[model samples]
Target: MSTILFHEIVYGPVHSRRLGISLGINLLPYDGKLCSFDCIYCECGFNKDFRTNTHLPERENIKAALEDKLQSLRKENAKLDVITFAGNGEPTLHPKFAEIIEDTLFLRNLYYPTVKISVLSNGMHLTKTKVFDALKKVDEPILKLDSAFDATVRIIDRPNSPQYSVSKQVELYKKFNGNFILQTMFLRGEFEGNKIDNTTEKEVSAWLELVREMNPREVMIYTIDRQTPTKQLKKVPLEDLKKIAERVKQLGIKTNVAG
Candidate 1:
């Protein structure tokens, strides 16, 4: 059981390889994971195994905890870059997601006006108007789009709903009006009896074509950096990641690769 659950509502002004000096907001419960996508490469293990709290954290409580952190950071004059909504699961799944984003932006102005507010989401909740509206407000609305092929998406992401389709996801991305950052997690592994790998030529080709369609602000490409729930999963090599990045660049899309 390789678990990396965030056990606090307000955690780390930790250094991020891609986003600098981020203070993470874990909207999910302290002990459990609740995400729409059960990614084989998720840092936090699978859903049922690690979940502890059924009730989502209260809006007031999250604000209080965040304010406390922001105030402390302000007192120290800390170099904060972004306030990211990413934790045990999909932050947008929180019922009061839009309200929280509103609170976060207000707080951002009061404490660190220049710092960006970001949300790390699986894009499953985009159909919901409120969730989509809130996501558009963030500086970095980072949405996951690991693969363009529906079958590969089903295998790699294991979306909770059987109805999950890549074409629909691309449409949701279109709603953003080329204003969002697209993130992809490239990996190779086996789940149950099936062989899983998204770094292949076929996978990348499909993905590249779709990335071109989205015409996002930028494309983030990365490999597994921590132990995944699935022990058999393997990280896509940096060289191979860069190769994919080069192809993405050829599409005239800026690509960011992280190990």
Candidate 2:
């Protein structure tokens, strides 16, 4: 069995393909995971195992701890690349998320001024003004749009609500007007007898159309980099990812692929 990677308040300055060495902040609990979507590719496992009513870190405590950590890293002469808001679940779901962002900004200025702040969000909460405003403060708000079709989204992402529509989600993304980094995970396979293939021509066509409409600043085309909840899921090869990247580049859209 694979042990959960991020079940704590702070994780690694782990090697990240895009963010370089990143210091992770996990606002969620160290045992259970709490997320709006139960993605098949989530490394922390599904929202079922450790998912339940739980307590997240208080905003002030998070700030103090982060400040202390940053100061310690500085003393050790350890280089900090990015302070990422990612871990077990959706970081934005914290009630004081906005205040947390403000505190992070202040601490970054005081200690790691050169470090960038990035949040890996599911884009489910982007429709909220508070979430949007708070995320706007970050250096990069990389939002997820795993698929363009509502049915495919429901199947793959398995969001909390049945009424959730991918089209509406993309529309909310468009409201950002290309201010965000759009992250996509490309793959093909089956999960529980349902055929899952997001790399098909039809799927790619729809995704590209959505991209054209959103006009994002950049797109991160990555694949499964960790263990997943579903065993039957497949990974997209790096060479094929490069081909997709090539097509994205042709559209004059910046893209980075990590397979």
Candidate 3:
């Protein structure tokens, strides 16, 4: 199984197709994966295969590490567009997630006021009060919604909670009040002998309906950009992704396609 893991608390100012020049903050363990959803296409690979023996970085450690990196970058005058919260898993899962966000905000203002703060989440913990509030504070709360149907979500995201449903996710997203950004990964192939393709007319139509309801500030539509854990999966062509983006644009919501 191919995987890419961040083995540090604060990692690269890597060029992100969606978020731009981003300095990553890995709130999860430095050794393995920790996520609510075991996505087949996750570049970090499946959770079980990358069980972590390490602990989540303490709030103080994260703050210290981020400040140190920022100070160093400032001295060098490095170009950084955003500080992104994403790692092996769900960042909101951190116990002091809200406090950490506050620390990050302060540091961002002190170091790079113009730089944005983004959180790339699976939206599994949005119902949590702290997580919701923390996400609200960020510039881009990029939450994932790979499918509009519960069945399709289960197959693609494979959320840990058996009760996780698209309906619940939609309601949680509604709480954002059009303040969040909806991100969807479009792909097709077989998984465990089951054929999967979320770009179908039926799927996209249902997704567009939900998009209309959520009315997010923006929609990020993209296909697999990195090697996925599931070899059977295939990337949706750029033309198809642009077609989807056009549908989102028709909804009057800004759409960013990373193909």
Backbone Cα, N, C clashes tallied per candidate: 1, 1, 0
lDDT of 3 by residue, 1-259 (tens): 7679999999999999998999999999988999999999999999989997888899999999999999999999999999999998989899999999999999999999999999999999987899999999999999999999999998999999998999889999999999999999999999998899999999999999999999999999999989999899999999999999999999999999998
Question: How much does candidate 1 score in TM-score?
Answer: 0.98
N/CA/C clash count, model 1: 1
- Write model 2 residue lDDT over 1-259, tens digit each, in one string: 2347576576777889878999999888877888899887788888877765667888878888898898899999999899999988888888888888999999999998999999999989877799999888899999998888988887888899776898888888888878999999887778878899898888888888888889888999998877777788888999988888888888889998898
Please estimate how well model 2 matches the true structure, expressed as its whole-model Cα lDDT: 0.86
**Which runs in model 1 stand beyond 4 Å of their true positions?**
none
Model-by-model lDDT, in order?
Answer: 0.91, 0.86, 0.95
Better of 1 and 2 by TM-score: 1
lDDT of 1 by residue, 1-259 (tens): 6788888999999998789999999998887889999988888988878867468899999999999999999999899999999999899989999999999999999999999998988999999999999999999999999988888888888899988999999999999999999999988879987898888788888888888888998999998888888889988889999999999899888989997
Comparison by TM-score, 2 against 3, better one: 3
Candidate 2 clashing pairs, residues 3+ apart or interchain: 7-30
Instruction: Note the residue pairs that clash in candidate 1.
Output: 32-51
Top-scoring candidate (lDDT): 3
